[model samples]
Target chain A: MFYLLDLLGTLAFAISGVLTAMNKKMDPFGVFVIAFVTAVGGGTLRDVLIGRTPVGWMLDLNYVYTIIASFILAVIFRKKLEKLRKSLFLFDTIGLGVFTLIGLEKGLDTNLHPIICIALGTMTACFGGVIRDILCNDIPVIFRKEVYATICILGGTVFFALLELNLPINIVYLLTPAVIIIARLLAVYYKLSLPSLERK
Target chain B: MFYLLDLLGTLAFAISGVLTAMNKKMDPFGVFVIAFVTAVGGGTLRDVLIGRTPVGWMLDLNYVYTIIASFILAVIFRKKLEKLRKSLFLFDTIGLGVFTLIGLEKGLDTNLHPIICIALGTMTACFGGVIRDILCNDIPVIFRKEVYATICILGGTVFFALLELNLPINIVYLLTPAVIIIARLLAVYYKLSLPSLERK
Candidate 1:
């Protein structure tokens, strides 16, 4: 079930990447590369930083296949996708929850500090979009926009707190994403955003 | 001597990062982060991909010290740095040569394919500036500009070819960077650049 969610997240992220690249008017090759990077760049960076050899996508053909499929579908349905923006956003939020959990789990396995684990989770969930925006020559939306990473950090905090309460691991896993998904939905629904910091 | 060259490269990269961030009018904290990333970003990425735990800088205080020192010096000497641009460019080129060699050596240590090793070399020598550009909201100059990565690729090819000729390891190291440095210098002197690819 968890693995399925991971794949879904990859698919959603890839489609979003394709949309961004298409907007940039990049060639097909550039679009594909952006899609691949947006889908897996975060997990790849996390794996590398934690000394996980061979990286994730290189070891698993599923990610590559999923990205390729997402690219083709997104390109073919670029027009229709406009009407499906709400659905796409939901999938992206789901991805945020799942990827953050995966990163947190990996950090725990490696015996990292909770703060570091939270940071890892945030990076895993948000960095793919950061890379995508960078490739398209834009300041990353996360650094300036909505409380996206803030939700991940909150979810991670709740995750660790649940663990401390001696809750069942299954329940912890179930509730963490629930918190993240709902919190993100609320944030977006209410038009919440972080204020920009500037020196006067 | 190699270690010293590595530090020198770190220093040069950090200074360059500082200049770029200052141009972007980033805050002091932002400037320091950019400088740090530009100094160690390539090596950190290389180390992560290769599964080197604790990373290069984490295990070595010298790198951190070098970057911090470089940041301070660059900030204080910003006005005078314009006059030292030629010297700074020389150092940056030297960094490119040394960093490429370090990455190549690491890849060989891990028994990766020659092609992958060359990629590792290029990434090590060029990716810091790429990250810097991304953070500064610009397309990576390496992806568009002169024969920067091209020089690294050529240097890596020469390195393996020399190794195949049964040359001494010391001679190989010495010649590899020499090839990269001289090639880069000549390329810049001749105003050589890669042509942009455009889809009609």
Candidate 2:
């Protein structure tokens, strides 16, 4: 079930990347690269930091193949996919929630401090988007705008608490991602965002 | 002194940044930020990888101030600095050499495998420029151009072998950067870039 959730999240992230590249008017190759990076960049960074090298993406080319497949799918159905903006958003939110939990788990496995783990979770959820934005020549969401990272952190805390309560791990996993999606969707609905850093 | 070498390198990198931003027609504020990132970026990445939080530039702010000062100086004398193209190239080569040694030292301090340390040294010397180019919407030199990264690897090996032979540490430091600069300059002079990444 966890594996399924992880795969679903990866697909969702890839979809988000393709959409972003489309908005930028990039070519098919660019869209595929953007989607691939958005799906894997954060986890790759976490893995590198923990010294679990060759990196997750390098270990399995399936993620690369999947992201490319996603790009092709998006392009094949470009207009229809564009029309389903709300549905796409839903998938992306699900991805954010699940990827955050996975990142938190990976961090704890490395015996990192809880705060750092939570931070790692947030990074995992958000950094792919950050890289996407940078590559697209847009300001990073964390630097300019969004509730994206904050939602990840809130969800990560819930994950940690659930783990501590000795709760059923399966229930915990399901609840954690659900909580994250809810938080993110609600934040987007209300346009919630962290305060900007004042220009020095 | 290490301090003087560092400042000279920083100044050189800052000048390079200014030149790049000018070519792109970036505004003054953009130029300053670009210059600052170019000068300090590699070292900061090395620090983060080695778990040195509040990285060297973050801690000193002097480095930050210096880049800003250099930026201001560049803008105030844009035409003047542009005329010193030869000196600028020499300085950039020096920066490459000095940064490579510093990266190797930091990697070794973390007790990473010697080969990894050498890789880190090359990465540290090259990544900042790659990042700068990416942000500027250019193909990175390390990825496509002359033997910039190869020079850093050669210098890092020289540094490590010197230390293994228990040569005076200061002499090793001095010799390492000197070797890097000479190698890179020679490569530049001879147009000794890597074989074409493109297939015939």
Candidate 3:
């Protein structure tokens, strides 16, 4: 079940990456590269930070195939996607939640501190967009805009809190991603964002 | 000896990152973060790709100390450095050479493809600066302005070619970094750069 969620999250991230690359007028190769980077960059970073070798995508060739498939799909359905902002946002939010849970679980498996695990979760959820923006020569959207990473951290905290309360492992895992998905959807629907610091 | 060289390279990269952050008017935390990222980003990426766990800096806290020292030195000597562009360039070039050699050696140890090794060498030499530029919200300097990564690739090719010739390992290591350093210094002196791709 988690594997399915992981695959969907990869596809969602890849589509977002390809769309961003297309908007930036990158070439086909550039589009594919950016899409691949965005799809795996966050997980890759989490693995590196926690001393996991070969990373997730490297361990499984399935991710490469998934990214390629997503790229082709996005390119073909470009116009339809352009008219489906809500759907795109939904996929992205689902991606954010699933990836966060995966990262938090990986960190826990490594026996890292809970706070570090929460941070790892946030990084996994948002770093792909950070990388995409950086590659496109813009300030990272997370640093300047929405409460994206903030929500991930909050959800991660809740994940640990419930675990501490001796909830069933299965229930805790299920609720964590759900909390993140709900929080993100609500944030987007309400147009809620962190305030940007003004230049003095 | 190699350890000392590694530390020097880290210091040079950190200084360059701190200076760049200062020029961009970043806060102290921002400066420190950027410096730390720039000092370690390339090696971290290379290590992750090659399945090296814990990364170099994480396993060795000495890098952290070197970066902190470099940051303090860069800030105190910031005014003097503005007048010593030549010296800064020299340190950066030396860093490029040493880091490239280190990366190439690491790749060879992993028995990767020669071309991939060359790419790793180039990445190790220049990617820190690439990350720095990305975080500072600019197109990568090497991508548009300099022949930096190219020089590292050339040096790596030379390193492997020399190895194929059955040259002494000591001589091979010495010549590889020398080739990169000299090539970089000459490129800067001649103001040579790759031509930018024009939009059609």
Every model's DockQ: 0.17, 0.05, 0.14
State the lDDT at B124 in candidate 3.
88
Question: Per-residue lDDT of A1-200 in model 3, one digit per residue for the tens?
Answer: 88877888888899999989999999999999899888899888888777886678888999999999999999999888878777767777888889999888987887766766876798798888778878877766665556888899899999999999999999998999999999988887899876532222
Output the lDDT of residue A118, model 1.
Answer: 94
Considering summed lDDT, which 10 consecutive residues are worst modelled in model 3 chain B? B24-33
* Top lDDT model: 1
Candidate 1 wrongly placed segments (more than 4 Å): A1-43, A49-51, A56-130, A139-200
Q: Candidate 1 at B66: error in angstroms?
A: 1.6
- Evaluated against the true structure, the overall lDDT of model 2 is 0.79
TM-score of 2: 0.60
Candidate 1's error at B116, in angstroms? 1.9
lDDT of 1 by residue, A1-200 (tens): 98999999999999989888777766555576579889988888888778788677755678888998998888778878889998889889899999999899999999999999999999888899898887889878889886999999999999999999999999999999889999999998999998888898
Q: Cα miss at B27, model 2 (Å)? A: 1.5
Q: Quote the lDDT for A72 in model 1.
A: 85
lDDT of each: 0.88, 0.79, 0.84
In model 2, how large is the Cα lDDT of residue A77? 79
lDDT of 1 at A2: 88
TM-score, model 1 to reference: 0.63
Query: Candidate 3 DockQ category?
Result: incorrect
Per-residue C-alpha lDDT of model 1 across residues B38-94, encoded as one tens digit per residue: 988988888888788678999999999999999999999999999989988998999
Worst 10 residues of 2 chain A by lDDT: A24-33
Q: Write the per-residue lDDT of candidate 2 for residues A84-136, one digit (tens) a residue.
A: 77777887787888899988888988999989999889888889888888777
Name the regions of candidate 2 deviating beyond 4 angstroms: A1-41, A44-102, A107-200
DockQ of candidate 2 against the true complex: 0.05
